[model samples]
Target chain A: MHIYVTDHNGKEHELEALEGWRVMEVIRDWGLPIKAECGGACACATCHVFVDPDWQDKLHAASDEEEDMLDMVPDVEDNSRLSCQILMSEELDGLKVSLAPSAKPDAEVA
Target chain B: MSEQEIVTDVVIIGAGPVGLFAVFELGLLDIKCHLIDILDKPGGQCAELYPEKPIYDIPAFPEISGQELTDNLLKQAEPFGPTYHYNRMVNELEKQDKGDYLVKTDAGETFRCKVVVIAAGGGSFQPKRPPVPNIEDYENTSVFYAVRKMDDFRDHDIVIVGGGDSALDWTLNLAPLAKSLTLVHRRDSFRAHTDSVNKMRALVEEGKINFELGQIASLEGENGQISAVNIKNADGEKSLPATRLMPFFGLTMKLGPVANWGLNLHENLIEVDTEKFATSEEGIFAIGDINYYPGKLKLILSGFHEAALMAQAAKKIIHPDEKVVFQYTTSSTKLQKKLGVK
Candidate 1:
């Protein structure tokens, strides 16, 4: 499987992913500029992303725990979701998500 | 607030699980320690980020929550009588002329120690700033992350954002003082305590405050003075007259001031040797998730082993003339006595 992730600067990168693995792991394994601080535990909102509006319906709704974590994201949008909660599958191979500004590494903020 | 300097054998930089364990290891060697943490309590990320979350790989315990592990570690290190200084961050670290190291914090405290342990896990947790465009311009004037004094918000149209305890508690607290108060959140529901949420709902029922379901879109003001805060929601766009704005968006970790201490770092993690977990500088050590070595596993057990080895090395530096002895806590009566078992 593969996932399409857009960086904060709008640069798109196609990453090879494995089934059942988190979408966050795919983006981070490929050396993207993500701050997944809690390592996909949904403990932190550093992995926040904006799922493409077209692909929003294909994914399941955010769990209550995930929603609580999203409350930490300051710049969340209507399509916002934590990539860690999104699992890659054969049904949704090319899931497109744009990295939220809050998800970027703190060192790259400037 | 300059006070007398605190002299100790070792100064641990963090009060996390690993830092707390270091106190036990150092104590068995008859070395006293003083721990400093930025948080108001111990446990570091364990307490702050996931206090109730279960951890699976903590050696003996099959599944222990973050808070439980922290509590146990504190109990184990209690016999050492280590001092804990919370709510202060180490801002400056320099070697003194007398061979001891001088450590300074943002709270204006000074300490002299022979060994410095950099056990800070993932640096320090700081408030996450919202990505509102040009929000920086209004910081400290029209926008505030924390309320230092309630009088500063008196007579102003205050807009508090978020659904957490900080937002709801402040809304209920400052509502009586403000001319107009508005609570904005992305959703109508809140994650605060039931009592606080109920009080906030009562305030809304009394028409004493305004509740809006939306996120902050932008700020309106000039010269660091905000006039209004624009928000977007299901109904459409709306602007609230906000003389003061407070956003409680939780916290994120960043490699703070530790970067300026002139130590070798790899990807923001302190580089240390595997044998002693010592950093580039002598009398300084790095452990836990904050240190990096070849094939480092970053497990809690690995940090425990590092703490044991670092204690031995630290004991040598503090008392160079004394010959060190290796003893296990299980059979050695001397070690048992230090642990308060004998």
Candidate 2:
């Protein structure tokens, strides 16, 4: 399975994802410029991403913990979700997400 | 200004789990210690990041929360009476001519120690800088991450951005002082305490402070002073006049100052041997998630084991002529006496 991830530079990369793996893990594994500082513990909001409008309804809703973590993010939107909370599944084979500027590594942030 | 100098047998740079555990192991060998941490409290990430999260891997306990584990570790190390210096970062480390090390902190304190143990897990926790363009330009002037003085905001147009406790608390504290105070957040709901949220709402209703639902879009400034801040919300882009701006996003770990300590680093982590867990410098050890080895696992238990081994080496360095004897806490009367169990 795979997912489409657009980085902060507006470049899209097709990443090979595994079933039951976190979308953030897949993106980080593919060498995408994501901070993902907490390593998917939902302790931080560094893995924030904007889900494509079409894929928004396909994924599960964000939990209260995830929402609380999102409160720390400076640039959040209506569709902003912590990618670490989203598990890649067969239904999300082509899950589309665009990395928020806040998700990039601190050094890479312009 | 004259700095306070402390003398100790060993100086551990980090009060995290591993550093706390090192106190027990070093104390057993008759070594005294002093710990330094950047956080106001100890436990490092376990205390700050996920204090309530249950960790499943800790031995003996099937599930233990981070804060609980930290409290237990502190209890375990209490008999040793290790001193902790919190809210300070070790800015410089140098080997003295007398072979001991001199450690200097940003808080204007110094330590002379026989050995240095770095249990710094993922480095120091620092306030996250918002990704606003050229935000660095206004730092310590028009833009501040932390409020050091309430008088700085007095009579100034202040714009605070965040929904957490720092933002709300500062909003309430600085509302009376500012010419105009605006609380901006990305969402209507706040993650701060209910009391603080209620108080902030009361201020908004009283027309003392304005609450806006939006994210900071940009900053308008000149010569390191911001004149206005642009925020984007559901309605449209809005600009608020501001002399001071504070954005409290949260804390993130960065390998600060430690990178300049002349220690060999592998991928931003200190390189250490698995045997002694010692760094490139003699009498200096690195453990926990901050140290890298061939089969290193960044687990609390792994850090515990490294602390035990590192303690033995540190003891040897501190007291070379003393004959080292291996004794288990369960069987040895000397060890039990040291643990205050006798």
Candidate 3:
């Protein structure tokens, strides 16, 4: 399947993804910076991305825990999802996602 | 040869910031701990990745380097009676019939503890490299996924690959220290913060750093030293001389040896109880970066909170007869009072 990932820089890369792989895995395997701190178990929201408006219907509804995690994420929106929660499939062939800004603040150590 | 295992009050899987917090939490309850990690030193991944980089989000301290945080965490954990086994990886965890757990490491050592906490952060996700030829030969000698020490690159020519914050941030930080610094990215734009990108651009404009927008065609090095890096930029193929190649290309998380434990894992992360940080297994608990709990925040501060709560829950489970009274230390008590959590 084809997955289009828009990075934090607003650049998009169209890459081939395998069905059954989590969105976070596809992004990470393709060498994109999604963090996925909890590795897509719906734990940490670092892998959060916005799904394309058109393909949003293909994804499973976000769990309550995912909702809570999203609340803590900065710049959260109606389309926000922890990429680890979205599994790629034939139905999601044209999935489009944009990398969210990392919540980690600026460097303090000098 | 069934040798009796030496059991402890608790066993912590990693010695990073959260693991140290566990030590402190257990210490407050008069519980002894055995902490193990693969790094020769404490602080787990924080000490391994960006040890020189300053961290701003840690509570109280406005900013501290990874090394400093590790040092402070070690001091805090040590005072609480925790024994650390550095340079060891926990290869397996087996539950005993009596409800305790036995942890065996790759070093052939074993420890029995009532609770196990996995704080192995992004350390397990080794770096991912593009399909570039000749990159495998310099895995350790020159091409590196992590920066162990900053002084090691002093006065040397270095080439960094990646367009993200890690790559850009490191370039900006190391530009002044290295004799020559060249940054190559697959795309023109960067994923780093605007301020960082602006600073790097200023440096590049002043001829302090070289910014090459392109992909690495190949890597050339020999005898434990990287001599040059060849790249395919917008202008065509070009070769740049370098002493070391640091690829912040990004990390790929692996569950490592713990993947065999049969815990409910979502991809590479272990699922945990939202309230208690307990895993699907009764006595196994996860915290820090490797754990997944719905609605949980993933920051050092959030990890600290999770460690505190998990420690309390684990304590209650291990000592059912005892009443878990949280006696806040003076500092903690004062902070609690200020937050009005009375």
Candidate 4:
């Protein structure tokens, strides 16, 4: 399957994502600056991305952990989702998302 | 003034199992190594995640705890005398015109190395700071997350906040060095080791340290230097005279600036060839869980294998004329000499 990612520098990359990989895997494989610090654990929000409005309904529903992690991320919107939770599949082909701001240290709580 | 820039033959990016082994491997070939890790100490995920958990997979040991394994690795690499830069993250890696790389840290430290090894297991672990306004401004000054040098806090009025091991550990360590020490927490309970807690209580009884039950309300200082902290307790907000503040809340994992170094990544991991464990970038290699290969197992023993191969390849980069030879540590006099066992 194919997925499009717009990196932090506004450079777009079209990647061939394997069937079982997550959206984060595709972007990270392209070396596009997505931290994915926790490695798809849904614990860190470094992989937060804004799903293209057109493909919003195509992704699997965000789990409670993903929702909470996304909530912790700065500049989150209705389209905000952790790319790690969005697994790649045949139905989710051609997914497009723009990288969110780097999970800043300020976003962390005491 | 900036710290003196370091120059070495190899700069291992993580001081985990693979990185430590890389030091030993490279040292056998007469190459010096320097290691940088975001964590305050070595062991990476093993020490951070399950230090006490027993694992039966390591080669000779029938069973060993995570911390025990890390201790053994560090001991094994001690002969190499690898320089370890802890509590710092490598933020930049740029190739020099001479072909060596200049590695810069977020702390403004730099290293020039002929080979870079990424043994970063599962990414770098970052500290989770308390939510305070403009906290970054005070970082590395009066406010420190990790103590690199004990003498830096000698004779200073220090206030440590947290109920965990880091807070309790530093409290025990810095109590005598600090002129006036205070340990603050929301309640009297602590998640630290009982021995540390009892020792802390003893210090408080001996009038060496002040134990306060409260939470930090605000910080007071000027020009990134802290003088006092307003803590909220049952009596409401009260100002405590303090010169240095240490908040040991805990750590959070973040890959941090590694992705920006232009290395080829495969799912948040560096891609390396199996033969040399070399990344797409020349003179750079990745091992441990941070590197992906055709049949990588992400095991500590597997990383040890990668380290041996990586060191051989790194020798070519560090000294092209050096002839690489395979020698068994049990019988080879040269290998035993490097290990300092002969």
Each candidate's TM vs. the true structure? 0.96, 0.95, 0.53, 0.61
For each candidate, the alpha-carbon lDDT, in order, equals 0.91, 0.90, 0.75, 0.82
Stretches of model 4 off by over 4 angstroms after superposition: A1-110, B1-7, B38-41, B47-52, B78-89, B104-110, B132-143, B146-159, B169-182, B193-196, B199-245, B294-297, B321-327, B330-342
- Judge the docking of candidate 3 as incorrect, acceptable, medium or high: incorrect
The residue-by-residue lDDT of candidate 1 on B1-342, one tens digit each, is: 235798899999999999999999999999999999988899988899889999999899999999999999999999999999998899999998767999999998899999999999888887788888898898889899888899999999999999999999999999999999999999988888999999999999999999999999999999999999999998999999999999999888888999999999999999999989999999999999999999987777888999999999999999899987888899999999888894
TM-score of chain B of 1: 0.96
Give per-residue CA lDDT, model 1, range A7-74, as digits (tens).
Answer: 97889998999999999988888999889887778888899999999999999999989988889899
Task: List TM-scores of chain B, every candidate.
Answer: 0.96, 0.97, 0.62, 0.73
Residue B206, model 4: Cα distance from true site in angstroms: 8.7
Candidates ranked by lDDT, best first?
A: 1, 2, 4, 3
Worst ten in a row by lDDT for model 3 chain B: B333-342
Shift of residue A70 alpha carbon in model 2, Å = 0.9
Model 3: CA > 4 A from native = A1-110, B1-6, B123-253, B331-342
Task: Give the best candidate by lDDT.
Answer: 1
lDDT of 4: 0.82
Cα TM-score of candidate 3: 0.53
- Tens-place lDDT per residue, model 3, B212-260, is 8766777777876888888885578999998888876443334578778
**Candidate 2: which stretches are off by over 4 Å?**
A8-11, A107-110, B1-3
Instruction: Name the candidate, 2 or 3, with the larger DockQ value.
Output: 2
What clash pairs does model 1 have? Answer: none
Higher-lDDT candidate among 1 and 3? 1
Model 2 chain A weakest 10-residue run by lDDT: A101-110
Better of 2 and 4 by TM-score: 2
Q: Which residue pairs in model 2 clash with each other? A: none
Worst 10 residues of 4 chain B by lDDT: B126-135
* lDDT tens per residue, model 3, A9-107: 789999899989998889888887666654454544567788889878778898766674553343455678888788888988988988876422110
Q: lDDT by residue for model 2 over B1-342, one digit each (tens)?
A: 134789999999999999999998999999999999999998988898889999999999999998999999999999999999999999999898767999999999899999999988988888887777899899998898888788988999999999889999999999998999999998889889999999999999999999998989899999999999999998999999999999988887878999999999998899999899999999999999999999877889999999999999998899999999898899999889988994
